[model samples]
Target chain A: MLAFIIRRLAQSVLVMLFVALIAFIVFRYVGDPITAMVGVETRLEDQEIMRERLGLNDPVIVQFLRFIGNAMRGEFGISYRLQQPVTELILSRLPATLELAFASATIALVFGLVLGVYTALRPRSFGSAIIMAASLVGVSLPTFLIGIALIYIFAVELGWFPSFGRGQVVDLGSWRTGLLTESGIRSIILPAITLSLFQLTLIMRLVRAEMLEVLRTEYIRFAKARGLTQRAINFGHALKNTLVPVITITGLQLGSVIAFAIVTETVFQWPGVGSLFIVSVQVVDVPVMAAYLMFIALVFVLINLIVDILYYVVDPRLRVDGGGAGK
Target chain B: MTEPLLSVRNLAVEFPTRHGILTAVQDISFDIMPGEVLGMVGESGAGKSMTGAAIIGLIEPPGRIARGEIWLRDQRIDNLPPEKMRKIRGRHIGMIFQDPLTSLNPLYRISDQLIETIRTHLPVSRDEARKRAVKLLDDVGIPDASRRIDDYPHQFSGGMRQRVVIALALCAGPELVIADEPTTALDVSVQAQIIEVMKELCAEHGAAIMLVTHDMGVIAEAADRVAVMYAGRLAEIGPVRDVIKDARHPYSQGLMGAIPRLGESLERLVHIPGSMPRLNAVPPGCPFNPRCPKVFDKCRTHRPATSEIEPGRRAACWLYPGVTEA
Candidate 1:
């Protein structure tokens, strides 16, 4: 088991390397960063000097190697638009995106598991039918469209929440105090709901089907025949057996969430790695963009590793060498 | 005579199909007395499992008891609500499936499953449950019961898993244990060991068993009385020795001749030639009519009512119409 886990850990390192290589190429080779930095209004002469200054005139390999070197040393150069160290700007904005992602994921998991099992338990019931219908519609709607619809309903029309921002750093003081305050929490509600809908629907559908299939298996039938309550059978036996698949799906979706979160951040105007990524891309701040890209990639690999570990914990069949020839 | 532990009277089960309603079990009736092992022998698709599921009220949606009276200890249990039936199941009437591995929850430890059954019916502390679980596992012949109780179902061998399943069913000390082909999935050698374990354990607990299987050899060895089901109806029922040595129903005879034995000639094993009738298209009178070698015009258009043959034997066939119980 230990050897298998160690091997899996090595595989995770490989994934990070792949992500880093792709990110580096995308940041360096695609389009001129200096043109974006100089803007359409800047003179060609000034642009040349800026290009030379930033070492954009160098070969792609030389530029990438230097970028990788500086990145490893925590020097993300400077933010072109923010006029600050790329690391400082990234660190400041990172909290908002992470907070949003965490909140959304929590919402998705709670609703998904609950509604999923509930529907599986009573698929033909009116309440379960309604939840199934709602989830289908929820899954069909695009994330951007959901965001816009949410902004209108909760922020504009309902007047229940703030449409944008993690709230001013000046107004709320520290991140600790900010979350505790009424305004900060209220601001996060709309964006969090919008982000969770698609993910929640996907999880609920998957969980419902997986749970139904498990319950039909002999083990579940025996559990029932043993006079275990319906609740015990559904939650204890059926749900636990279905979790490995759910975990894998959740990890993969979360990786996608970190990628597509930019659209949500853009809509909500919330400051996180997502909006940081967008601003860096638009202003051609390759250093900050690289920092954000690496962070997301690192998160993806870490989540996958966590999923594999959890799966082994759940099923000994997943444990290599734990069950010799039991495979 | 003491009131039987389980009395299933005129039970019928049906389900909605695309064409129309289909009856799975039609007016089936049987009784199980405490400490008596009743083997229900049948071909595949004989509605044997469905009958057991109906008795426990685990029949899910799209399938329901059309009309029935399931009497357990003077209580008419068929119409009882789901919660009530669920309580009765694994408590008064325990069940084991054909597959031992699948009969246990993959996520739970053996001890947890055993204790869960106990706690559901009777109030018991976790420590008490654990203590009882170890004893129950020991009773079922699981090795290292004291130490291995914490292991999951996947950790145990197939026969051992079936033992655990039996232990689970017997944990609540149920009056009636319905084993739906409990040893069907085990190896030939292991099958005998598991069945031996189950019979001994059940006898020790004074539990009546409704053992469903197609194997007459198993029925001959384990059962006191035997029931033969063909299609959706009971074809014959009597003492096990009578059913095996002198079966009243032709279908039962066919089943007996079906299995190959050493010293038997290379002649074709007698099989009821035609495919078993589908639920919706069962014959008007006798379910086994089409396959019966002595089938008559009356057998085709009119169903024959079950008639008593001897003191304890009853058969649903026209041949037994004039036989008087003496």
Candidate 2:
């Protein structure tokens, strides 16, 4: 297991390096960061001085190598627009984004599992049909549209939740944001629901499909023949078997959730890395943009690594050393 | 005579498809007395397995018991609510399927599966159930049962897994076990071993068994009485020796003749002329009429009801209409 984890970590590092290189090339070609920073009216000589100072005057390969060397030491160059270290800028927004991601994930997982299992158990019922139709709407409709609709219903008309922005956040020492606070939680409710809508439906559909398949398996019939209660057979035998695939999809979806959060954050004006990413992109802040790309890529790789480890933990078939011994 | 442990009265299982309702098992009836092993032998798709499934209350959906009744010791079980039926399943009657690999849950240990079954039906604590599970494994001929109890289903060989499945079926000490082609998926060499284990264990537990298979040899060795099904109906049912030696139904005769015998240099094995009919297009009268050599005008127009051919023996054929005495 240790060897497997170490091997995965090595692969993750290689993946991150590849992502960094791609981001560097893509950002460089997209636009001139110097022009975006200084505006169109800046003098040509002033732009030249600014370019030379930021190492844009160096060869592409030399500039990339220099960026790599600095990145290796945890030094992402200062953001041209913000005049702060790119790492510091991302770090400052990390807690807010983390809180949002965690909240949305919890909501998605809890509701998805419950609804998925319920619908699967009573597949022919009217309630299941209604839930399935709702989930389809959740999957098909755009997240931004859902965010706006939520704001209109709960914030604008109902006056239940704040329409925009993170309500007053309390810094609970060492970069932790206390979501336990009433304002912090209430502020995030609309955004979190908006962010997780798609993922919740995806998870629900995946779990339902998997459960239906597993419930038909011969072992489940055997479990039924064993006179296990309906609850025991559905939850204990059928649900456990469904989880391996569900967990795999859930992990992959989590990465997409973080990636897609940019839209929800923009709609709600939540001060998170996603909003920072949008701001940095508009100004062409190459350092912050590249670092953001690399960070998200690293997150994806790490999430995949964790999923692999989880597979080993959940499925004994994968844990056995030499294959073909067990069926 | 003592009341039969299980009684099926004109059971008919039907499946509703896009075309119409197709009958899988049509008006079939049988009885299993306590401690008796009744072997149900038939060609593939002849509804032998469906009979067992219906008896166990596990006929898959889109298919259901369309007619008649199933009684377990006077309790009418054919139309019981699912919850009530579930309580009787592993407690009063256990089921073993063809593939041992698919019968046991791969994620669970053999002991856990066995103990769970035992505890579900019996008022035993976990520790007590665990002990009984280990003993069941030992009884089913697993070596070092106590140690192997913790092993998952995949860890065992195909034959060993079938044995574990048999042990699982017997865990709750059920009075009747519906073993649907239990040894069909096993190797020929190990088939006898499994049959031996099942017969010995069933005898010890005094459990009635409905052993469904197509193998005549297995029926000869393990069954006291044999039921011959042909195309969704019972063609013949009698003592194993009677059915094997003097089959009254022409279909059973053809089945017995098809079995290759030992030390007899026959020119060739007998082959039945036609295959069993599909459910969608089964003949209006007797299902076996098209395949039987002796099929006549009456056979093509009227379905034969099961009638006594001799003492303790019955067959569904027009030829035996007047044979009331043994």
Candidate 3:
């Protein structure tokens, strides 16, 4: 198990390196940082000075090595537009995105699992049919549209929440969160719900399909024959089997959730890394863009690693080795 | 004189599809006395498994009991609600399925599955249930039962897993067990071993078993009384010896003839022509009329009711009308 984890960590590093390389190439081709920074009106000599200062005069490989070295030391160069350390800018906004992601995932998982199992259990019921139809709408509608609608209803019309921003952040010694204050919690409600809507539907549909399939297996029939309560058979036997696929999809969806949060962040104006990403792209801030790409790739790999470990914990059949052979 | 342990009177199962309601098991009736093994032998799709499923209240949905009365001792159980039937399932009636791999939960340990069944039907502590589970496993011929109880279903061999399934079925000491083709998925060599274990353990617990199988040899070996099903109806039922030696229904006679004899070097095995009809196309009269050599005018137009041929023998065929009338 330890060897497996170490191997996965090595793979993750290789993936991050590939992502960094791609992001570097893409950013270089998209626009010239010098033009964005010094402006088209600047003198050629002044532009040359800026270029040399930023190490752009060096060969691409040399500049890439320098970026990698500085990144290793937690110094992701200065942002071309902001003139501040890219790492610090990203770190400041990281909390908001992380808070939204965590909240949305939690909401999606809890409600998705409950509704999914309930629908699977009483598939012919009117309530289940309604939930199924609503999930379809949830999947079809765009996130930004959902966000705008929620803001209109809950913020502009009802005055129950602030429509935009992360509200007030409370800094504990090591951890910082906007969730501790009432207005801060209220501010995140609309954006989080908007961000989680699609994921909740995806999870619910995946879980409901898996559970229905599992419920038809012979063991479930035997479970009923064994006099287990419907609750026990549904939750204990059927739900556990359904979770393997659900967890896999949930991990994959988490990656997309972070990706899609960019649109949601723009709609709600949440001060998160997604908005920072948009700003960086618009201003041709290569350092911040490259770092963000690598960071998101790293998160994807780590989530998948955690998912693999969870698979081992949930399924005992996978634990057997060659020693169990020929028995 | 005592009431039969389980009585099924005119039990019928049907499935409702877009076309219409298709009858799967039609007006089948049988009784299992205490400690007796009633072997139900038939071809695939003969409704033997459906009969067992209906008894255990585990019939897949859309297919339901269209007509029947199921009595467990003195209690009328067929009309009970699902929760009430569930309470009776593991406590009064246990079930063994065709495939052992699919019968046991893949994620649970044998001990956990067994103990859960034991505790569900019996008011026992976890520790007590665990002990009983281990004992049941040992009784079903699992080696080092206490230690191996922690193993998952996949860890055991095919025969061993079936034994564990039997142990699971017998955990609550149910008065009756419905084993639907319990040895069908096992290897020929190990099939006998599982059958031996099931027969011995069931006798030890004095549980009446309705053993559903298509293997005539198995029926001859394990059953006290044998029921022969044709399509969706009972063609013949009698003492195991009588059914095998003096089968009255022509379909039963053809079935006996189809089995290969040990000493006789026959040119070819006697096989009955044609297959069991599909539920939608089952003939309006006797289900076996199309396949029977002695089929007559009355057989082609009227469904024969189950009638007593002798003191302890019964068959559903127009040829036995006079015997039944007497």
lDDT scores for all predictions? 0.83, 0.89, 0.88
Error of 2 at A37 (Å): 3.5
TM-score of every model? 0.92, 0.95, 0.97
lDDT of 1 by residue, A1-327 (tens): 688779988998778667667777877776777765665889989988888888888888797778777767777678767779987787777667777887888898999988998899888899998999898889888888999988898888988888888764433443432365578788778888888888999999999999889978878878877878888888788889888699899887877676678889999998777888887777677767777778777788888888888888888665645632231
Relative to the unseen true structure, what is the C-alpha lDDT of residue A243 in candidate 2, on a scale of 0 to 100? Answer: 94
Question: How many clashes does the backbone of model 3 have?
Answer: 0
Candidate 2 clashing pairs? none
Better of 1 and 3 by DockQ: 3
Alpha-carbon DockQ of candidate 2: 0.56
Best model number under lDDT: 2
lDDT of 3 at A143: 91
Clashing pairs in 1: A97-A272, A218-B102, A219-B102, B285-B303
Candidate 3 wrongly placed segments (more than 4 Å): A321-326, B323-326
How well does candidate 3 match the true structure in TM-score terms? Answer: 0.97
What total of clashing residue pairs does each candidate reach? Answer: 4, 0, 0
- Candidate 2 TM-score versus the reference: 0.95
How should the candidates be ordered by DockQ, best one leading? 3, 2, 1
